[model samples]
Target chain A: MAIFRTCPDTGLKIHSQAEALIKANAVVGIVFLAIGGLFGIAVALTRWPAVHLLDPEWFYLVLTAHGVGVLLFWIIFFEMAILYFASAILLNSRLAVPKIAWGAFALMLAGAILTNIAIFQGDSSVMFTSYVPMKASPNFYLGLILFAVGALIGCFVFFATLVIAKNDKTYEGSVPLVTFGAITAAIIAVFTIASGAIILIPTWLWSLGFISYIDPLMYKIIWWGMGHSSQQINVSAQVAVWYAIAAMVLGAKPLSEKVSRSAFLLYILFLQLASAHHLLVEPGLSSEWKIFNTSYAMYLAVLGSMIHGFSVPGAIEAAQRRRGFTRGVFEWLRKAPWGNPAFSSLFISLVLFGFLGGITGVIMGTEQINLIMHNTLYVPGHFHGTVVAGTTLAFMGITYLVVPLIFRREIWMPRLARWQPYLFGLGAGGISLFMMGAGTLGVPRRHWDITFSDAPLSVDVPGTAFLMMGLNGVFAILAGLGGLAFIINIVGSVLIGKRRDKTVARTNPVVFDGGAAVAGYGAEGTMKVPGTVVLVATFFTAFVLYYYVNWKFLSEVWPLS
Target chain B: MAIHPPADRLWWKEPLATSEVIWIAVAFLWGLVMFFTMIYWHFAGEQNLSSEAYKISPEKFAERTEAMAAKYKVREEGDTGVPVVRPPAGTDIYMFGRLWEWWPVLELEKDKTYRLHLSSLDWQHGFSLQPTNINLQIHPGYEMVVTLKPNKTGEFSVVCNEFCGVGHHTMVGRIYVVDAK
Candidate 1:
C-alpha cells in the first residue's frame, strides 16, 4: 500500500491493511477511557457529600489506575495511530510487522489488566504521582514498567516504518506538516518512557528489598520527564491530528507553516525543563534553579503554544474566508458545519484546552504563584483543561471522523456522534473549574475526608464546588453513553453496515497545491519518509536526556549527605 | 501529483550579515537586565550568606527562655519575658537547606511567602506539598524554588513525594502554621 498523493493515481491508497492494529489499539484505548472515567467518577463520589465513594485506600487505587489508564493508555494508544500515520499512511507505506504490532498490543493489554488487579486488590495504591511514603504492591510497579515497555516497542515499530518509507523514497521535499508533529510527539514519548523505566525499575528493586537504599527525591525529579512531559506529548500528537483533520475537512491550512511547525517543535525543545515547574512549593530546592528551570524555560514552551493558538485559528479563519462565508469575525463561526461531529469535537477541545488549560498552567508554573496551587484539586482542574477536554475529546472526535471513513460504513448514530464531544467537554470543563475553585480555598487532594486531615490548612473553598464536580461526572456518564454509541457505530459499520460497490477507497489519484486531491482506486500505495532519521534522532535525544543525564542526578544523593 | 510551493514568500528573509551583530548586541542588553534580578541570590547562596534557615532542636528551642535567650538573641523577648522567634509578617523568609529525605523534619511558619530554596541533602527529593500537588525538584546545587503562601492555619505534612529509598514511604515533614499575631 502506497500513500495517496493525488486522486488519479490508482497506486495511491488511503485504507491501511494494518487497520486491525489500529482497531486493536483503539479497543484498548477506549476500554481505558471508560475505566478511567469510572475512576474519575470515584474521585467525584469521594469528594461529594452524597455518594462518598473515596475509601482512602480505594481512592488511592482509583487515582493510580485513573492516571495510568486514562492519561497513559487512552492517550498513548490513540497517539500510536498518529505515529503510524506519520511514518506510513501519510507516506503511503505499510507496517514493518503486523504481527509484532499485535504482540505489543497484547503486552499492553496484559499489563493494564495486571495493574488494575494489583491496585484494586489493595497492593500498592499510591496515586499516579507515586511519591515516596506511599507504597503499592510490586505488581503495581511491574505492571507500569511492562506497559511502558510495550508502548515503547510500539514506538519502535513506528520508527521502523519511517525507515522503511525513506528507504523507498515515495515522495519529494520535506515531510508533510502532520508528519512533523507526529514525529515530535514520538520523540517526546520516547523520553517519557525512559523516565518511567528509570523510576519504576528502581522502585521495583526497592520493593523487593533488593536495594537497601533508594532516594524518593531522586525518583521524583526523574519521574516528571514521563509524568508532566507526557501530557505535552499527548497535546502535540492530538494537535497534529487537528491540523490534518482541519485541512481535510474545512480546507484549513496553517497561516504560516514555519510558525506552526516551530510551535510544535518548540514543545520538544522546551517541555523537558518546563516539567520542573510542577515542583514549586516543594522544599529542599534552590530558588535560583527553580526560577530558571521552571519560570524562564517554561515560557518558551508556552510561547510555542501561544503561537499555535494564533496560527491554528488563523488557518481556520483563512480557510473559511476563502470559502466566502463572509459575515464578520463571528460569521466564520456560523458558517462552520455545526452538524459535523469531528469539527465540533476538535474546535471545542482546542478552545477549552487553550483558554482554560494553557492559562492556568502558565500562571501555576510561576515560582511565587505556585505556592497557591501545588497539591490541591486545583492541579487536577488545571490539567483536565488540556488532557481530558483537549486531548481525549479530540481523539474521540477523530474516532468518529476517522473510523467511519476507514471502515467504509455509515456511522450508526450520527446524531449521537455529533453530540458526544460537546457533552464530554461541558461535563469535564465544568468539573475541573469547580475543582480549581475548591483548591483556591485550600482544599487538599488525596484525603479520604477533607474533614479528617491533620494538615494545617485554611481557606474553605466551597462545598458546592465538589457538588458541581460531581454533577459534571453525572453528565460524563451521558458522555460515556455517547462514546458507546461510537463503539457500536464502529462495530456495526465493520461487521454489519451495508458496503457500497465503490469500496470507498481513501485517497484521490490527483494532487493539487494546498488543496484536496483526486480520489484513487485499488490497493497500490507507497509511503515516503524523508525525516525518519530526524524523528528517531529527536527521540534519541529525549532518551538520553531522561535516562543518561537525568539518571546521574538520580543515582547519587546531592549535598553529600 | 504535483507538489507546489506557495505563490508568495514573505519579505522577512532578506537579512544582512551585520544584522547578526546588531541582534546579538540587543540580546546582550536584555540579558543584562535579567542578570540583576538573578545576581543577588547567586552571591547570597554562594558563601552560605542566606540570612535565614536553621536546624533547631527541642533543647535549643526550650533553652531560649527570655532570661536565658536575650543574651544570645536567637529568640527575642516580649514585654512579658516570653521568648519567641518573631519573624515579622510579609518578611521574605528565606529557607535554604537539605530536607534529609523526610518532612515534619522541616518546619516553616504560617502567614508568609516563605521563599523556600531547597535541595536534597543526599538523594534527589521531589518536594510535594499537600492539598496541592505542587511538586518540584530539590536538585543539589541546581536549586528548586517555590514561593509558598501558607494560607492554612494548621499543621500540613511536607513529604518527599518522589519515591527515593527503602524508607521512602516514611519521609515526612510538618510545617506549623501558627495563627498570625
Candidate 2:
C-alpha cells in the first residue's frame, strides 16, 4: 500500500514515495546546475579576450565539464523530476516502482561523478562531442553510458506509471495536457538515450584499445543523433512547463486542444531529423539528404513550434479577457501578472526563444547559409538563445511555483524572486546577441585567442569582435548573479522557510475539474485574441526579414559550386 | 485546465477558432517557403557546398599535399619557412590540415575556379576561411574537394574553428588571391 499526503494548498493527493523522488531528483539537478554554472562563468570570462582568464589546458577541460554537467546531467535529472510529477502527482496515482526510481537516480549520480572525475584527471579534455581519434579516458565514455542507461530506465518507469494510472482509473478521460506533454518528452528521451548507447558503448571499447579505430565521420553522424535529440527533449519539457504555468496562474486553457496536440505529434514525427543540421557542412553527405533532414521534412517541426507560439499566449489572452480585462486589445496583456516570476519568466522565454533561438536556428540550419555560420561563435550564440535563455529560464521560472506547491514552504525572498527572471533574461539575451555579432564579423568558436598572439599566422579580427566579447563577459556576470540569487532563494526556502498553513490563502491554486466540459468555446463566447494576433504578426515579420538578410549575407561570401 | 484531462471525451473533434486556423495556415505556408528556398538556392546560389568527397589513407593524402607543395613552391611565408605555393588557375590544388597548422599556403588568381582538396593528417579539423567566411569540416581518412572561385583580391586567413587539442588557436593557414591579369 502506498502512503499519501493531501496538499492543503492544492487539495490534491500526492503519493509520499513519488514526492520524495521528485524532491531528490530536483535537488540533485540544482546541485549540478550550481557546479556546471561555475564552470560556465569561467568559460565566459576566458572567452572575453579582455579577461582571457584560463590557460588553454584548463579552458578545454572546463568546457567539457560545463557541457556534460549542465547539458546532460542537470537537464536530465530535472527532467526525471518532471516525469515523476507529471505521471504520479498529476494523475493522483502511485509511482509504478519506487525502488526502481531510486536505483535510476543512484546510477545517474554515479555516472555524473565518474564523468567529472575523468574530465579532471587531465588527459580527457576532448570537449563534449568527443569526436574520434582525439580520445578521452575510458572512464569518460563509461560514465556517459551509465548515465544514458539510468535515464533510459527512468523513462520506462514513467511509462509504467502512466499504465498504472490508466488501470487504476486515477482520473477521468485522457491524461492532462501537462502529462501529455511530458509523455512527448519521455518518448524523445527514450530515442535519444538509445542513440547514445549505440554510439558510446563502442567508443568506450575503442578507448580501452579493444577496438582499433572508430571512424570520425560515422561518430559525428551518430553522436549528434544523441546530442541534438537531447536538446529536442528540452524543448518539449519547456513547452509543457509553459502550459502548466499559464493554467496555474491565470486559469488558461488551450485555444484548441486539437491544434496543440497535433503540434506535439508533429514533433514526434519530424524533430529528430534535425540532427542533419550539424552535418550540413560536413563531407560525404548529399544536398538532398541535407535539405530534407535539416529542414525537418519541410520544416513541419518548425510549424509545430510556430503553432505552440500562438496557442500559448492566445490561451493566456483569452483567459484574461474572460476575467473582464476587456477595455482594449492591450488591456488583457497589460493587466497580466507581470510581477509573478512564473508568469514573467514564461513570457520572456516565449519571446526570446521565438525571436532569437527559433529564428537563428532556422537560418543557420539552411544548407547553403551554414557555410558562413558553421563552427563560428554563432552556433553557441544560437543555442544560448534556445537552451539557456529559453529552456533554463523557463525551468527557473517553474521552480518558484514548485517550491510552494511541492515543498509546501513559502518562498524565502519574494522580492528577489520577482526580479530574478529579468536579470537573467536580459543578461542571457545580450550574451546571445553579442556572440552572434562577433560570429558575423568572422570570429571563430572554441579558439583560445582571436588575436593570434601565440600563432605563426595571425587573423585580423575586427575591433568590434573584441567589443562583442567584452559585452559577453559583462552579461555573463549578470547572469551568474541571477543564478546565484535563485540558488540562495531556493536553498533558503527549502531549508527554513515557514510551512504553509490551512488559513493561508492559495494565491495560485491547482484547479482540476475532473475532466468535466466547461461551457463557451472562446473568451466571451466568441474568439477574440487581437493582442496575440498582433504579437504573432510582429514575430512573423521579424522572422521573414532576418531570414532574407542571412541569404543576402550568404550571397556576399566567395562563390562555390 | 492544463493539469487536468480534457473535459470533453471528444476533445480531438473540438473546433478551432478563426484566428487559430489562420495562424496555422500562415505558419505552415512559411515552413513550405523556407523548405523550397533551400532547394531553390542550389540552382541559383553560388555559395552552396560541394558534395564531392573521397576516402583516402592519411599517408596517401599527406604524400599528395607535399608533392603539390614541392611542385608549385614560390616563396616561404615569413620566418616559419612554410612554403607558399602559387598553383596555376583551374589546377587541382591541395591544402593539408593537421595537429598545428594548415601546411604550404596556396596562392590563387581572382575570378578563376580551382579544385581545392582538403584533408586532415592526424585529428579532425575545421576548414574555416575567414573574411570571406566559408567553413567546412575536415576529417582524417577522407578528402573533401571544394570548387572555389575567389571574386575578391586579397589575402584570406584559414582559422581552424574546430577544437583540436591545445594548439587549436594557433592552427592558421593563408591564401593569397591576386588579379587575373
Candidate 3:
C-alpha cells in the first residue's frame, strides 16, 4: 500500500509517489527553462541591430533550439508536474501507476535530449515549424514523436487518478474547481498529443527517406493542429494554476463554480479551431473555411477566455469584500497583498495575459487582420505575451507556494521573491510591446537582419523599429535576471532552507487567515465585485481602442481590390 | 496548511449571483458583436487577398516563368543588372520562388490591376511586400493568384519572411510600379 502524508497546511493527503514525481518534473522544467532562456537572450541580442550577435547560420540554429527548449520542453515538463499534483494531491488519491509515470518521464527526457542534439549538430536547423520539403535529420522528428507519446501516456495516468479518486469516494461534489481546470487541461492534452502523433509519425518516416513526399499544404494544416493546440493545453493549464493560486493564497473561491467550469469546457471544444488562423493566408483554404474557422464558432473560445477574465478577478474581489475590506468600491483592490510572489505574479499574469496576449490574439486571429500580422515579429510578440508573461509567470508564482507545501522548506531569499514578479512582468510586458511595435513597422519574424546591406538593394526599415528592437534586447536582459532570481530562490530553498518543525507544520497550515469569512466561499454574500467590475471595464476600453487601431492601420496598407 | 473542504461542496449547483450572470451575458454579447463585425468586414472593403488558387507542378511553373522572362527582359539604365521584365497591364504574371531568390523583377503599370501567380520551386516561402506591409505564405505545388492594383507607383521589395533554410533572409524580390506614360 502506498503511503499518504496529508499536507499539514492544505490538509490534502499527498502520496509519496506523487511528491517525488512532482519534484523530478519541476527540476527538469527549470533546467530546460535555463537553457531555453539563455538561447532567448542570444536571440534577442541578435535582433538588436546595435548588437547583431550571431551570424545567419548560428542565429537560425539558436532560434530552433530556443523554440524547442522553452515552448515545448519546459512548459510540457512543468505541466506534467501540475497534472500529477492536481490529480493525486488535490483529489487525495494515490497515483494510479507510479512505475508507468517514471517510464513516461524517461521517454520525455530522452526525446528532449535527442531533439537538442540534432539541432546543435546543425542538420536540424529547420526552426520549430520544420515545414516539409525543407527536411531535417530523422532524429528531430523521432524525438518529438517520443515526447508526444510520453506526454500522452502521462495524461492517461492523470485520467486514471481522477477515476481512482471518484471510485474511492475521496471527498467532494464535482471535484473542486482547481482539479476541474486540470481535467480540462488533460482533455486538451489528449487532443494535442493525438494531432502530433497523426502528423509526426509519418514525418519521422519521411525524414528517414522511407516515404517519398509530404505535401506542404497538408503538412501545415495538420501540423498547426498540433502546434497551436499545444499552446491551448498551456492556456488551460495556466488558467488552472491561476485558479489554484487564487484559492491557496487568498482562500478565494470561484465567483460561480459552474460558470467557470463551463468556460473550461468551451476551451476543449473551440480552442483548437483557433489554429486555423495560422493557415488563413495560406493557399488552398477557402475564404469560407477560413472565415468560419476564425469567427463563426471560434468566438466561443474567446468568450470562454472573456468569462475567465472577468470571473477570476471577480472571485478575488468577492473574497476580499467578505473580509470587511468593503469601505469603498475600490478598497478590495487597494488591500491586495502586492508583496507576496504568489499573489503578485498571478495578478500580473492575469493583467498582462489579458491586455497584451488576449486582445492581440483576438485581433490577429481575425481572418482579415491575420493577413497583415501572420509572419511578422508580431506573431512572436503575441505568443511571448501569452506563454511567458501569462503562463510562465503564473507557474513561477505557484512555485513559491509549492516550494513550501510540497518541498517542505521555507523560501530562502524572501526579499528577492517579493520583487521577482514585478521585475519579470514589467520586462516581459516590454518585450511583447516592443516586438509588436517593431513588427507593425514590418520587421520580419525569422530574418537575421532587417537591413539587408549585402543584398542588391539596401532595405531600410523605420528608425523607430530599430529603437524597438534595441529596447526588446534590454527587456530580455531584465527578464533573464528575474528568471535568475526565481531559480536561486527555488533551488536555494529546496536544498538548504530550514525545514519546518512537525508541530509548526501541523499548527501553521498555509491558511491566509483563520477567520470564517476568509475561508468560506462567500455563498451568503451579495457577491458584488465592484472593484473587479471597474477593472474589467478598463480592460474592455483598452481592448476596444486597440481593436480599432489595428483596423485603422490595416486601412493604410496596400489597397488590394 | 490545514485543509478545509468547502462548506458546501456543491457550491456550483447553487444559483449564480446576479453579478456573475450579468458579466457572462455582457462578455457573450461582445463576442457576438465582434463575430458580426468580422462578417461585415469580409464583405465591406476588407483588403484580404482573394483566396483563388490552383495546384501546379514545380517544373511547369519554372518553365513558364523562364519563357516570360526571356520574352520580356529589358536592361534599362541604372538597373541593378538583375533582369527586369516589363509585362503589359492586366495580364497573368508568374513568379517563381526557388532556393533563395524570387525570380525576375516584375514591372507593372500603375493604377492597372494584374493577377500575380506565385508558387515555390523547392520549399515554402513567404511573399511579404515591404513598405506596404502585405504578407502571404507561398508554397510549392500551389499557385496563389493575388489580384493587385498598385495605386502608388514606386519600388516595393518582396522579402521572403519564412524560414526556408539559412539564406532566407536574403531572398528579396523587386516590384516596380512605373507610370504608364
Candidate 4:
C-alpha cells in the first residue's frame, strides 16, 4: 500500500506523499518569500530617510504584510516541509495520514490568503504583535486562528509519522540525530499553536463583538508565547538542519550523541520561557516573573544553544580531521569545502547567529540592560541576526541539497549559488549591526522617521545615528539583491533545470552504510576537535566583551536617587 | 547500497567527550554568573525599573494629570505649543498619554528622584525616554510607575516607540530636567 522511490542523488527512500507535500509546501513558501521580501525591501528603503519610499499608511500596512508573509507564512511553510522530510523521508516510512496532511495544507493556504487580503484591504494595519485595544477586522483574527489550527494539525501528523516509523520498525535503534531535533521543533510547535489558539479565538470573538474587552497586558503575555516561541521552533529546526547538512556533505556524525540530544531536550523544557523577555518592560508583570524568566531559567535555553554551537562545528572539524586535514588548529577549518555553498552558508549562519544574534539576545535578555534597548531598532536588529542570517540562511544552504535530492534537478546557476551566502550574509549582517548601533544612539523601532521634524517635541539623534540608518538602507538594498539571487536560483532550478538519474554521477552524494546502523558517537581518533574548541573560545570572548560593553552603557544612564 | 536502520545503539546512553563536559560546565558557570549579576543589579545597583505599578481608569488618570499641571504651573516657555509643568523635587508626578501627546510636560529637578506614573488614555503607547533610551509600554488601564532621577540637566525627549496608529511617529513628549538647587 506504500510506494517509496529511492532518491538517486541523496540515496534516501522518499515516500511519494512526502515528496508531494514537501514540494507543495516549499513552493508556497517561496511564493510568500517573494511577496514578503518585496515589502521588506520597501520597508528598508523607507527607513533609510534618504529614500523614505512609502508614506506612513502604506508603510504600516506593508510592514504588517511583510511580517505575516515572511515571518509566519514563509518560514512556517518551509518548516512544515522540513517536518515531513525529517519524519517520513529520514525515517524511510510512509506518512501516517496523507489525506489529513492535504487538508491541513489547504487550511494553511486559505488562512494565509485571507490574512494577506485583510491586510492589503488596508483596515487591519495592526503590526505583527497586534497588541490589543487596537482593533482589526474580524477576518484578520479568523484567518490567524485557521492558520494556527492548520499548523497544529501538521504538528500532529509529524508526531503520527514518527509513531508509524516506530511501529513499522523503519529504523533499528533510536531516531537519527536530525530526526530527534525535528521532534524538538514539533513539540515546540505544539505549544506555540496551542498558545495562539487560546488567545486568537477570544480575540476573534471580540472583533465580532461577541466579547466586550480583551485586556492589553493579558494579550501581550499570551501572544508572545506564540510569537517568540515560534522563533524558538526555527532555532531548533535550523540546528537540526545544521547537523543534517554536515552529515550529508562530509559524512559527519555528532561529536557526542547524548550531549547534542540533551541540548534539544533543554529546548523543550526552557526555550518558551524566553518569551518573557518581551514582557519585561510591561507594567503588569512583576520583577520576580521577569527575573525568573529572563535570567535564571531562560539561561538554560541559552546553554542549550551554546552546547549545539560547540558540537555542530566540532562534528565538522572531527570529520575533516579524520579525512587528513589535521595540521594546525584551524587546518581542518581552512581546508573545508568553501566552494560548496551549503558548507559556506552553514558556516556563515553559525558564526553570524552566535556572534550577532546570540550575543545581542543575551544582552537584551538581561533585565537591567534591557532598559536601554527595549523597543529600539536594536530589537529588530537582534532578530534579523537570528531569523534571517541564522534560520533563513541555514534554510537557504540546505535548499541546495534539497533541489538535487528531492526535485532531482541540478542548480541552474552554480556560480551565483557560491556567492549568494556572502552577499546575503554580509548585507543582512550589516543591516543588523548598523541598526543596533543606531538604536544604541537612540533610534526607536517602528517609527517611520527618526528625525521627527513635524513632531511637537523633536528628538536629538546624533549624527552617527543618521549615518547608521543610511548605511542600513544601502545594506538593505544589497540584502534585497542577494535575496533576489536566491529566489531566481531556486525557482529556476525547480522549474526548468535538467533532471538527473542513476546514470549521472552524483557529486558529494550522501553515502549510507549498508544496513549497519551508525551511532552518532565518533571514535576516539575522530574526536580531535581542537579547531572547534578554539572557535568556541573566540565566540565566548566576543560575547563577554559585548555583554560588558552594554552593561557599562546602562551604568552611564541616569542613576536612581 | 541497501537502506538500513541506524545501528542498534541507545546513543543517549553513551558517555560525553571531554570537550563536551568542559564546554557545558563553562557555559553553565557563565549562566550562573549572569543570574547572580541580575540579583546584584536589582538590589545593589541603581539599575532596572523594578518600581510599583497598578491599574487605573483612563479618565481618572487624565484628571489627576490635569490637577498636577494646575498645582505646579510653570510660566517658562516650552518647546512647540505644549505648556511646561515643573513639579517640585521628591513628588509623585502623573504623565498621561492620550491619542497623540503626553500631558502636562513635567519639568523635574536634577539629582532628585520623582516617582513618574504613566498611563494611556485611549490605546497602548510606549514611554520611550530617548537620549537615555529607557522605554516602557504604557497600557491604557495600567499605571507604570518609574523612579526617575535625571543626572543631566537638559530637556529630554519622549518618543512613543509603540505603534499606536497612523500618527504614531509624531507622538512625542518632553521632560525638562533643570539644574539642581
Candidate 5:
C-alpha cells in the first residue's frame, strides 16, 4: 500500500529497492555500452582493408575484442539491466537480492577483462563468429564461455525473482507489457547460451587436443545458434525499449499488449531456428537443410519484424489519437518530437534495423543468393544495422529517458541527448549502402589488407571511394567517442549531479516509469521535457563505427599462410 | 510447435503473404531460385556448375586452356598463365570437377549466354564463380548447371570451392573473357 524509497542524497524514503535494481542496471548498461562502443571502433579500424590501422596480428585480436566487447558483453549486460527492470521495477515490486545484482556486474566485468586480455595478447584471431579450425587461444574461448555462463546465471536470477513475484500475486493480470517483452528476451538468451555451450565447450576441447573431431559444419550450425540467435535476444530487448521509449516520451502504451507479447514470443520461436542461415554458404550442409533453414526461416523472422513495425507505430498512433489531435493522417507524424535524443535513437535505430539489416539478412538467407553477400563487407553492414542501428541505438535512446528516472538525476546535457540519434542513423545508413555495393564487387571479410590479390579476388581501388567515404563517416572511433559522451552524461548525472526538490521527489521517484500505474496513480508523476537537437550526434558515432568495419571488411586482406 | 500452414491454403494466407506483401514478393523470388535449382538437379541428376569437363592441374589447365581456347575463346593471357574472364557475377557456372580438374578451359567472352553443366568423376571439387561470389558444388553424385554471361572483365577465380580432400586449397581455375572484336 505504501511506496518505498530512501534517497541517499535527500534522505527521503520514496521508492523501493526493486526500483534501485532497475536504476543500477541502467547505470551498468551505460558503462558497458560505452566500452563496447570503443571495441566497435577498434573492430571497424581492423576491418577496413585500406586504412589497416592495426597489423594482421592485432587486427584479428581487436576483431575478437570488438565482437566480444560490443555484441556479447555490452548488449547482453544491458539486457540484464532491462531484465531487472522487468522482473522488479515494471512489476511494481522490489528486487529479491540487490547484492546478487551487483554480483552479476562483477562477474560480467571479470569475464570482459579475461576476454580483452586474451584478445590483446594476440592469442585469439578466429574473427567474431570464430568459425571452427580457424582457432583462437584456449583462454579466449574459456573467457567467452565463462562470461556467457555468468550471463546465464544472471538470467536465472531474473527468472527466480519473477517467479517470486508470480507466487506473491502482486499483479491483477498477466505480466505488464514491458516485463512480458523482457521475459521473452531472457528466455531467448537461455537458448542463446545453451547453443553457445554446444559449440564452445567442444571447440575448446578440440583446441586443446582433448577431443578429435568437431565437424566444422556442425560447429557452424551451433555457433549461429550462439551467434545469430543471441542477436535476436538483442532484437527482443530492442522491442522492449520501443515500448519503454513510447511510454516515456509520448506517454504511450502498447496498442495491444497481447499482440506485443505475441511478437516477442514469435521472436523466441523463430530466432533460434533461423541461425541455420549463417551456415547457408558454409561447407557440408545439405541443400535441402539450407533451403529449409535460411529462406524458409526469413519469412518467420521478417513476420515478427513486420508485426513490431506496424504495432509499435500503431501504438503511437492510437495513443496520439487518444490525445484527440484529429489532424490529417500525417498530422501525428509532424507533431511528434523529432528532436528528443531518446526519440531520435529509437527512430533511427528502427529505420536502420528494419530497412537495411532486415533486407541484407534476407538476401544472405537465400540458398543461391548467399553467394553474393556471405563473408563480404555486406555482412558487417547487415549486423551493424541490427546491433548498432537497431539494438545499441535503441538502448542509447532509452538511456536519455531512463537515467533521470533510475538514478534520480537530471540528464547532464539534455540537448546533446536529443541530437545524437540522427548522426548515428545517417552514418550507419551510408556505411550499409557502401558495404552492399562492395559485396556486389566481391569484397571478402575478415582480411587484414587488400593490397595482394588472392585468386578469388581482383584489385579495384579508386572505384571503392564511395565506400571509403561512407565508412570514414561512421567508423568506430568516432562512434566510441560518441558513446563516451553518452556514458559520461549518465555517470556524471548519477555521481556528481544534485537531486531534484522535495516536491519533485515526492511527486515522482522513477524518472521514466512509463505511466503503468493506470488507475492507481502512484506517488510519482512523469515529466514532459521539450525536445532538443543533440540526438543526431549520438547516432553519428554509431554510424561512424559501422563505416570503419565496413571499409575494413571490404578492402583488407589478411595474409594467411 | 510447428505452425506451418497447409501446403494448399488460399495462397494469400500461405506464409509471408499473410505476413507482409512486400516480403511475400521477395519470398516468391526465393521460391523461383529454389525451383530453378531443383530443376537443374532433376535434369543433371547432380548439378556442378563449371565449364571444365576434365580434371587437371593449373599447369595442365593452361595446356588445356590452349586446346579449349581453339575450341572456344581466350580473353586475357598472363605471363603467370592465369587468364581472366568475366562470368556474370550473380550466375552459377556448372562444370565437372575432380581432384585435378582443369578449371574453365573455355574462356568466356563478354556478353555470351553460356550454360555450364557440371559434375565430378572423382572426389568432390568446387567451382567458385566470382564477382557474384556464388559457388557451384560438384559432387560425384550431384550435377549443377550455371547459366551466365560475362558481366565484368577480370580474372574471376574458379577455385575448388569445396574441400574434397588434400590439395583442396591449392585447387583453382580461371575464366578470361575478352572484349568481343
Candidate 6:
C-alpha cells in the first residue's frame, strides 16, 4: 500500500512519493534558473554596447551557457515536475515505479552537471543550436544526449502513471483539461527526444572522430526537429498552467470542455511543424515545403492558440460574473484579485504573450518576412516574449499557489510577491521590444559586437540601435531584481515560513471538489462575455496590423527571387 | 475545475456559446488568409527566395570563386588585400564565405540583375546585407543562387550574422552598387 497524505487545504489525496519527486524536481529547476539568469544578465550587458561587460570570448561562452541552462535544463526539469503533478497528483493516484522516477532524476542531474562543466571549460562555446562543422567538445554532445534520454524516460514514467490512474479508477470520465494538456506535452516530448537521439547521437560520434563528416543542411533540418519541437512542448505546458491557475484561483471552470480539448488535440497534431519557421531562409529547401510547414499546415496550430486565448479569459469572466461582480464589461476585470500574485502574473503573461510574442511570431514566420528577420536579434526578441514572459511568468504564478497548497506554507514577503510579476513583466516586455527595435535596424543575433568596432571592415550602425541596447541593459537589471525577489520568496517560504496546521483557518482554501455534481455547460446557457469578446477583438486587430506592417517592411528590402 | 474530470460524461457534446462560435469562425478564416498570403507573395511580390541551389564540394566552390575574382579584378579594397571585382551585369557573380571573412568585395551596376552564387568553404554562415536588411543562410557543400537586382546604389555592408567562430564578428564584406552609366 502506498502512503498518502490528505492535503489540509484542498482535501485532495497526495501520494507521498509523488509529492517528494515534485518538490525535488522543482527545487533543482530553480537552481538552474538562478545560474542561467546570471549568465543572461552578462549577455544583456554585453549587447548593450555602452556597458559592453564581457569580452568576446566570455560573452559567447556565457551566452551558450545561458541558452543551455535556461532553455534546456531549467525548463525541462520544471516540466518533469509538472508531468508528475499532472499524472499522479491530479488523478489522485500513486506514482507508478517510483524507484525508476528517482533514477531518471539522477540521470538528468548528472547530464546537466556534465554539460555545464563542458561549457565552462572553455572549448564548447557553440550556441544552443551547436550547428556543427563548428565542433564542440565530445562531452558537450554526450551531456545533451544523456539529458534528453533521461527526459525521455521521465515521459514514459508519466505515461505509466496515467495507465495506473485509469486501471485504479481514480477519476471518472476523461482526465481533467490540465492533464490532457500535459498529455499533449508528453507526446511532443517523446517525438522531440527521438529526433534529438537520431541527430545528436551521430553528431556525438562525429565529435569523437568515429564519423568523417556531417552534412550541415541535414544537421539543421534534423536538429530543429528537436530544437523547435521542445519549445512547442513549452507552449503546451504553459497553456496547461494557465488553465490550472484560473481554476484554482477563481474556481473557474472551462467555458466548454470540448473546445479546449480540441485545441490541445490541434497542438499534438500540428504544432511541431512550426519548426520549419527556423529553416525559412535556409538553402536547398523548396518554397512549397517552407510554406506548408511554417504555417503549420494552414495555421491550424495557430488556430489552437487563438482558441485558448479566448477560452481562458472567457472562463474567468463567467466565474467573476457569478460572484456578483457584473456591473459593466470592465467590472469583473477591475474587481479581479489584483493583489494576488497568482492572478496578476497570469493576467500579465496573457497580455504580453498575445501582444508581443504571438503577434511577432506570426509576422516573422511569414516566408518573405523571414528574409528580413532570420538570424537577427528579432528572433531572440520574439522568443523572450514567448518563453520568458509567457511561459516562465505563468510558471512563477503557479509557484505562489504551489508553495501554499503543496508545501503547506504561508507565502513569505507577500508584499514583494504582489509586485514581482509586474517588475519582471515590464522588464521582459521592454527587453523584447527594444531588441526587436534594434534588429529592425539590422542588428545580428549572436554577434558579440554589433558596432563591428574591431572588424577588418567597419560598418556604421545607426545611433538608435545603441539607444535600444542601452534600454535593454536597464531592463535586464530590473528583470534581475525581479528574479531575485521570486527566488527569495520561494526559498524563504519553503525553508522557514509558517506552516499551515489544522488550527490555522483556511482563508482561501483551494476548492477541489473532485468535480462532483454536473456543472452547467457554456456558462449557464446564454453565455454573456462582452468583456472577453472585446479583449479578443483588440488582440485580433493588433495581430492583423502587425502582420501587414512586416509585409511593408519586406517590400522595402532589396528585390530577390 | 481544470484539475478535475468534467462533471458530465458527454462533455464533448456540449454546445459552444455564440461568441465562441463566431470567434472560431473568424480565427479559422484568418488562418486561411495568413496561409494563402505566403503563397500569394510568391506570385505577386518581387522578394521571394529562389529555390535554385546545387551541391558542390568546398574545393570546387573555392576554385570558382577565385576564378571569377581573378577574371573581374577591378581594384583592391585598400590595405585589406581582398579583391574588389566588378563583374559585368547579367553575368554570374560569385562570393564565397569562409572561416573569418566574406571573400572579394563585389561591385554591381544599379538596376541590373545578376545571378549571385553564395557558398561556404567550411562552416555555415549567414549572408546578412545590412542597411537593406536581406538575409540568407550559407551552408558548406551547398551552393545557393540568389537572383539579385540592386534598385538603389550605395556602399552596402555584408555582415556574417551566423556564428561561424570566435572571429564571426570580424567577418564583414563589402558590396558597392555603382550607377548604371
DockQ of each: 0.11, 0.73, 0.55, 0.55, 0.09, 0.77
Candidate 2 backbone collisions, by pair: none
**Candidate 3 local accuracy as lDDT?**
0.85
Superior by DockQ: candidate 4 or candidate 5: 4
Model 3, stretches more than 4 Å misplaced?
A: A296-298, A503-509, A522-526, B1-12, B76-80
Task: Kindly list the per-residue Cα lDDT of model 4 for residues A1-561, writing each as its tens digit.
Answer: 778898775566789998899999888988998889889888988998888999999999999998999999999999999999899988888998989999999999999999988998999999988999999988998888888888889999999999999999877678888888999999999999988998999998999999999999999989999999999999999999898888777777777777888899999999888778898788857777888898638389999999999999988887787777889898888889887888888999999999989889989989888888889999999999998889888999888888888888888899999999999999889988998988888788888988897777767888898899999989888888888999999999998977767765354353433122333334222276888889999999998888888889988888742
Error of 4 at A247 (Å): 0.8
What lDDT is reached at residue A412 by model 6? 82
Best by lDDT: 6
- Encode model 5's per-residue lDDT on A1-561: one tens digit a residue: 435765432242333655665665566556666665665566566556555566556655665667777788778777877887667666545566667766776777677778778777875755677655556778778878887887888888789878877787655446666776788889889998999888899888988989875655466678888888888888888988887777666656543444455567777776777776666544345666666566444456555665676556655554555455446554665677788788778777876786778756765665545554556556776787788878888988887755665666677776666656766666556656666666556554454444333333343334574465347435455555556667777777777766665566566443333244232211011111111111222333443344334333322221100
Superposed on all Cα atoms, the candidates' RMSDs to the truth, in angstroms, are 10.4, 1.9, 1.8, 2.2, 9.9, 1.6
Please report the TM-score between candidate 1 and the true structure. 0.73
Give the TM-score of each candidate: 0.73, 0.98, 0.97, 0.97, 0.74, 0.98
Better of 2 and 6 by DockQ: 6
Estimate the overall C-alpha local distance difference test score of candidate 1.
0.59
**Native contacts matched by each model:** 0.06, 0.81, 0.50, 0.54, 0.04, 0.80
